[model samples]
Structures are given as structure tokens and as C-alpha cells.
Target: MEENLSGQLADAVAQGADEADLARARAGDEAAFTRLVEPLRRELHAHCYRMLGSAHDADDALQDALLRAWRGLARFEGRSAVRTWLYTVATRTSLDIVEARGRRALPADLGPSSDRAVLDGNAPLTDVAWLAPYPDAGLAGDPAGPDARYEQREAVELAFVAALQHLPGNQRAALLLFEVLGFSAAEIATMMATSTTSVNSALARARKIVAHRVPPRTQQRTLRRIGDARVREIATRFATSLERGDADALVALLTEDVTWSMPPLPNWYRGIEAVTDFAVQVPMTRCPSWRHRVTSANGQPTVAFYLGDDAAGPHAAWSITVLTLRGEHIAEITSFLGPDGFAPFGLPASLP
Candidate 1:
């Protein structure tokens, strides 16, 4: 990690890095540029995740931001710290993507559901793939310090990010800048090329909308405790069952009216039986000797699996599973195999 973070561009961001590093990069020093930006990889990735809702987009955007940052390094002019400038580039890039897609939310957003049991407010919008909750563990700092002051739970929670999506892209950017990143209104105004008043107005409206949509503290706490314990228990049991191919135990953890879907796979499965049939009789049957290792994803327990001895290398990443727990059972499971899906939740590249 140190070697990776200490390259040429690394010299650029170094405490007393010679101004010459930037000058050299400007003259086309790829090594210098890489060094300058490498240290920010994790933070930039997390920032992208917050803005884009999907780790995949975050990874892509982070890549784009780094590439763009390198290309534009000479022009950076120390207007802001390299970090802040990179953030501006990333946040804008993310909002552009959000605006282009008009943002995403689902049926759960349109109505309440059991998901509400885990949050402080209304049901999540199912149609919308809201921001996946980031693990508190993802955050590294005085967890209680002002640096981490954004409503940690609410900031990355699926429902809140979904509410944020409802706001215009600029408003979402403003809120993240002001509330999450602690940027001043004037700074945000400059970023969005708007007045302080516009930034303030957008934030006010965003907050009001968020308040109504987020769950109450009392409700959230109770549900969280119940949900947390249940989720961990279910994930542990679920993984054990899958390892043993215990069809009965596997079926038992699923809710009677559960739903399971594999994104990028088109069809959705409903209820325990359908899920059971699909898991056991279909894929599991084909890969009878498969193995799984537990990791975390989307703020939930996730299973990262591989088949045979050839599963450790590149492109071998299989399904990335996200669970929804209710009591001692899982109510829903989403198996995401998108290339970038394994990130953000901090699931490893391969199981040990």
C-alpha cells in the first residue's frame, strides 16, 4: 500500500512535494500523476458510492475522476486542494449520471413495506435501487468526531439515499456537499455555478423532504436492534445451510412471501418455494461442489462464492448476495454479479 501510494503523483500531494512534480506531470509524467492520486483511492471510492448509489458506478466514476484528474493536473492551479478538486470532479460526474438517468427509486418508495421495519420511515421504493447502506466500518475516524458527523446511519441507508434521489440532481449535490461533506454554501454555489441562496433553498427543501421520509428515532432504534440481531443470525445460518446444501434449512430461513432477484438476470422469483427451487434445483445442482466464504455487502452479510480450483483468478467473481432479515429468517435475497457489485460493502475479491 505504501509503495502504491508513494509514486510520482504521490510526490505531488506529499506534504512538501516539489511543485516540480505537477510541472512534470503537466509535461506528461504518468508516474507522477498516479502517485499524486493513489492515496485517495478508498475515500474517493466511498464518495463515489455515496453520490452514485451503486459501487459499480462509484468505481467507474472514481476511475474516470482519476483519469480526468491526471489529464487536468497541470491546470488544477492549486485552486483547491487536489483532494477537494477531485471531489468536485467526482460529485459533478456523479450528478451528471444521476441527472441523465433521472435518478432511480422503486415501488417500495411509492408505498410502505416490511422494509420499513428496518428503517425509521415509510417503505423503500422497490423500483428504485436506492443508495446501498455503507457499513459504519467503512468509515475510518473518530466515529463520534465531527469529521464523521453526517447522520451515519441515515446518510448511507437505502431509504434516505432514495429520498435524496427525489430532489433535483443539483439539490442532491448541494445536500451532499453541505451536509455530508461539510462544504459551505458559498463553496457549493461555486461548484454548481449558483448563488448561495439557491444552495440554501435546495438544502432546506431537501431536509424537509428527508424528515418526512426518514423513520423516527424511537422506531428506527427498536427496529435496528431487532433487525441487526436477526440479520447476523440469519446470515450465519444461511451461509451454513448453503455450505451443507441443506435444502430444508435454506427454505426455512426465507419468509413465506419472500422475494429474490438477481440483477442483470432479468427474472424475479417470488415466495419461498420459488426461491428454493431456483437455488437448489437450478444453480446449486449444476455447481454441486461449490464453496462459499462470508463477507459483508450493502451493510448486510454477504456470501462470496467460487467453484473449483480455478476460481481465485481474475473475472472469477461469482454472485454477490445481499440479504434482508426479519426475525430469525431472511425475507429477501438479491444476488448481484455485476463486476463492481462486490465493492463498497468491502467484500473481498476472493474468499480465504
Candidate 2:
């Protein structure tokens, strides 16, 4: 009887061992994958988000990377470890989505801008499309120990993203791969299935184009050193004035030459007076009880405003407000709130 019992106990242990191997094989070991991915997820998401420029697309791309990781686990062969493989999958997928013309998207909040808008009689704006903004809060680099990421921060601002739209796709990919992702030209060539010479040439051309587009943020160097509280106070005041429908007060806070725009909308009002005019005419006239929740969005200082309150919660985080401050005054306001934006901003679709 004792011998028989011991045999049964041994059989049970063997079964448990078999199950463990099977679980590992399935890539169904959630705890292990979590540990593998946790460290790099946020940064990876940022890369994908910048590449795609939509939070929803970034989320999807991340999910796709995860699934691909699961499927390709056996082939991982420990050559590059999990992280690099994930990055490789991520970049290829982002490039594929971009190159395939399959996953291109723009914020639903912003509409088209007028070609004839006067900017010092600037011959109608040539860049008509709306590019989404990124919040500075999500930047992967350290904010302290200061070489000052002035250029880098400006590079991710709402305005720069708009400039990136003008580049051809491959140049865009190459520039992002080299500059933002910190990948080698040879590595990019491997990823793109091209020659090093080809990648280098593309990088040079991309640099030239982006150089012309990136206006030196002559202000950012001094701007970054300012205390955070002082800046937040100014932003808060502007938010309060905006919520009160007091355009005069809002205008008082804005620079005389401030540029105001809403994505997916054709009208772009430049100068404090013009912006004030539009502010008085729209929004305040119709939407009442609009509430702004301060949150980091699109690598900038942003507020997610909800237009109306439903019984359960706020419905559809309407607009992500990106404020560009030059000293104490706001210079550029870009509100990107297009259709289907709630998901990207991590907001609920409908209030209960």
C-alpha cells in the first residue's frame, strides 16, 4: 500500500512538471512576460506613438509587438534578447503601417486650416494638415543633470510634429529611426532591407529637410530652466479664464502674436486679436459647463476638456489643449480633438 501511494505521488509531480513546460512553451507565462516587458514598455510606446503620432495607433502597435513576441518566442534564440527583438518588431511594424499606407491617421479634433490665412501676408499657409501634439511629461529622457534637452524638447513639440508631416515617408522613417530611436545607420539599413549607403544618404537628406523646418527654439534654452510651479500657475490662470468664457482675460494672457488653431478645422487664427475674435464667436456661444482636466498629452502641457457631464462620468475627453508659452505669455495654442480621440487619450467613450 505504501509503495502504491508513493508511485501515485511521483506521477502527480511529473504531471505538474509537464504542465510547467507546456505553459512556458505557450508563452502563456504572464508573470515572465510582464517582467520582460515592464521596463521598456513606456519608452517603446513613446517611440511607436511618435512614429504613428496617435496614441491609439501606438497602443495597437504595442499590442501587435506583444503578440508577435509571443508567436516568435521560439525563434528568439537569445541572439538579441527580448527587448531588441521587440524593438525590431515594433519599428518594422510601424514602418510597415506607414509604408503600406494602411495605418495612417490624424487627430479627429482638428480640421483643415485655411490656405489664405494671413500671417504677415504670408501667401496662405502651405502646410494645411493638422499634426497631433505630444506632451512633455512623457519624454523618455531625464529632465535634470542638465545639458538641457532644449533642442530635443522642441523637436517633439506640437509645432515640430506639424513640420514632420512635410517629409516624404522614407525620410521621415529614417530620421526618426536615427535621431529619435538612437538606432545606427547600419541597423536602420538592416531594418529597412537597404544598403548602408542608401540609409546614410537618406539620413543626410532627411537632416537637411528637418533642419530647415525646425526653427531654433531660441526661447527654449532659457524657458526650460524656469521653475515648474511658476509655469503651472500661469497655465492654471489661462485655464480658468478660458473656462469662464472671458476671451478678454484670455487674450490678456496671450502674446500679441499668438497663433491659435484647432485640428480638423479649417480656420487658424493668428495674433491675439484674431484668436480672441474666434473664441468669442465659437465655443462660448454653444457649449456650457465645459470642464478641463489637466493631464499630460502629446508631449506638451495639455488639458483634456469635457464638454458636458453625463450622470456616470465625463463623456469623451473632447480636446487635448497644447499651450506653448514664451516667457509668461502663451504664444501658440493647438487643440487637437478630432473624432475617435477618446481612446487615444485614454478616456471613456461615454459617461454613464
Candidate 3:
């Protein structure tokens, strides 16, 4: 009972602080506005990434949303918490972007997988808006909400975010707000400026679609089961195998149904045979040398690859390869090619 009372006291204190900040913000104190929003920015950015598949797009959407909130501060009637108000602004801003740009896609979504290694100089699909990886560093420990269905990191999983791209803007917003963020139906209805019935319908449709696409088990669960040391060993072995051009070593780590995709390259290979063919023929053979740094993306193990022609020469950034594992074996390898993905992860442009 004492613990419960102490918790209630903390909440009351926080609420009072927020009220003071809100009043100052409303009176055109920019510093107060910054103070009010700074705490929520990271989670808000993650929310934007879920809404829009690309972290770059999320950056823009969040900036625009914050600007909108700052301009409309006078209209914010203290009826709801500041976080909810910011989310409402962010969600609506993201919906507008979704409408204008449409959804991002992975190479697998474009066409059927190639049965053999694509030897031809397959050019990157510059025209397509491809899905980008999220840098999930410092995000794993933060709590979403007690009522949230998906954990904070689970919501940003590549498969989950990619599935969200398949949803319509309204349905996507409703689902993220209700399921991932744990906003109530009535609250979502208000945020979305729609009826509760409409929000319910959207949520139902969104859930059905997401359920079909997303895997039954989340990467977080898999990582926990595998343990941190083992997971690191797997990532290291995979990266080392690639760097050493050890095809046999690489093949040993993969599941029979493993998939290999390089986006914005249109061709993707599925199954061990096809993936092995592609790996041996391309990165292991044609590409001269490779250097890698293990990283994390979308709550999955990742490797940042750098390629160089001369073995001793500086290797330039190549792809951010995100590995999706099923048990001890890797089930999917999504290598998001090009240097654009490196900066977000704070990866160096080249390796000496």
C-alpha cells in the first residue's frame, strides 16, 4: 500500500511539472516547448518509423509533426496528456506522408525469387521506394506501456514494419496507436478524428493483415532464448565467414529455407541452394574483399559490409545486412545495399 501511494505521488509530481511546462510553452516560451517534447522524441521517432518504413522518412515526419505542434500550442486544451497530443500530431503528419509517397517495399515484394544466382549486372532499382533499416541502439530497454500488446522493440521488427507498409494509412495509424502504443479505442478515435466504430473496423482489418505477414515468434523472444553471447557468436561467425569468403562456413549457418535479398536490387534468392549460389558467385567471388562490423537493426542482428578491390586498400560501405533467425539457423538475410544505410547506424564510411 505504501509503494502504491509512492507511485501515485510520483505521477502527481510529473503531472504538475508537465502542466507548468505546458503553460510556459503556450505563452510562447520555445525553451519550455523543447523541454516538454525532448523526453518523448525518441519513442515518437520510433512511432514514425513504424508508420513509415524508412528511418529517413520518420526523421522528416517527426520534424514536421513537432513544427505543427509548436505552431498549434494555443489549441492544445489540457484535456489529454502531452504525449498523447504529440502522438496525435505525429500520426496525422505521418498519414499525410503515407498518402503522398505511398508504401515502401522490399525486393521480395517486387517479384518471384530467382531460382539461381543472378549473375548479370542487376542495377539497383532507383525508382522504387525501398524499406530502410532502423538503428535500434539504446531502444531495447525502454518500456512502451503496460497495456501495449507488442514490446517496444518488437513493433519495429523488419517484418512487422514491412507488413505495416501493406496497410492503408488510416488502418496503419489505428493499429499502431491501439496495439503497439496501447491507446484505447476511444482515445484513438479522438486522435484519428473518426468514430470508435470506424477505428475498430480499421484495427480488425490491420490486425488480420499483420497477423498473416508477421512471424509467430518475435526476434526479441528468439534473442532472449539464444542468449546474448550466442547471438553475438552467430553474428560474428556470419560476418567472419563473409569476410573470409568461406562459402562452406556460411552455408552451415543457414536454414534450408533461408532467403537472401539485396534491396534496391530487384533479384532475391530463397532456399539454401539459391542463397548459397548467390553468396558464392557474388560477394564471395566477384567482390574482391569485405570488412564487416556487427550491428543491430529492427531488433535483429546486423552486419555492415565494406567492399574493396585491393585486399589492403580502404573498403567503402556496402550494405547493412539484417539477419532474421529461426532457432540457431538464419532464416532470412536482407542486405540493404548502398552507403545510405550506414550513417543512421553511425557506421564509418570506409574501413582502413
Q: Which candidate, 1 or 2, would have the higher TM-score against the true structure?
A: 2
Q: lDDT (0-100) at residue 40 of candidate 3?
A: 89
lDDT of 1 by residue, 1-352 (tens): 7787678556656655635555677889887766666666666666676677666677788888787787667677776666677778888888778766556543344333332112123222345453443444554431221443365444665555657767887778887777777778888887777899999999899888877875444223434777656656677778677656788888888889787655444455677767777677645555445556566554456666544443343334566676655555666676665435455546565544
* Model 2, span 1-352: residue lDDT tens: 9999999999798656544543575566766666566666776776676567666666788888877877776676654435456777787777666665433323322444333333343232324434555555456542221222234455566555554555666677677767766667777786677899998998789778767866565335435665567667666777777668887778777998887776655467777667776677656555565666666554455666667643245555567777777767888787776536555555555443
Q: Superposing every Cα of model 3 onto the true structure, what RMSD results?
A: 1.3
TM-score per candidate = 0.64, 0.73, 0.97
Considering summed lDDT, which 10 consecutive residues are worst modelled in model 1? 115-124
Runs of candidate 1 with Cα error greater than 4 angstroms are 1-14, 18-28, 105-148, 151-154, 160-163, 211-233, 242-261, 264-291, 305-318, 324-332, 337-352
Question: Model 1, residue 277: what's the lDDT?
Answer: 72
Between candidates 2 and 3, name the one with more favorable TM-score.
3
lDDT of 3 by residue, 22-51 (tens): 999999999999999988888899999999
Flag clash pairs in model 3.
Answer: none
Off by over 4 Å in 2: 1-34, 77-81, 102-130, 133-155, 218-223, 308-316, 338-352
- For model 3, the superposed segments whose C-alpha errors exceed 4 Å read 1-6, 138-142
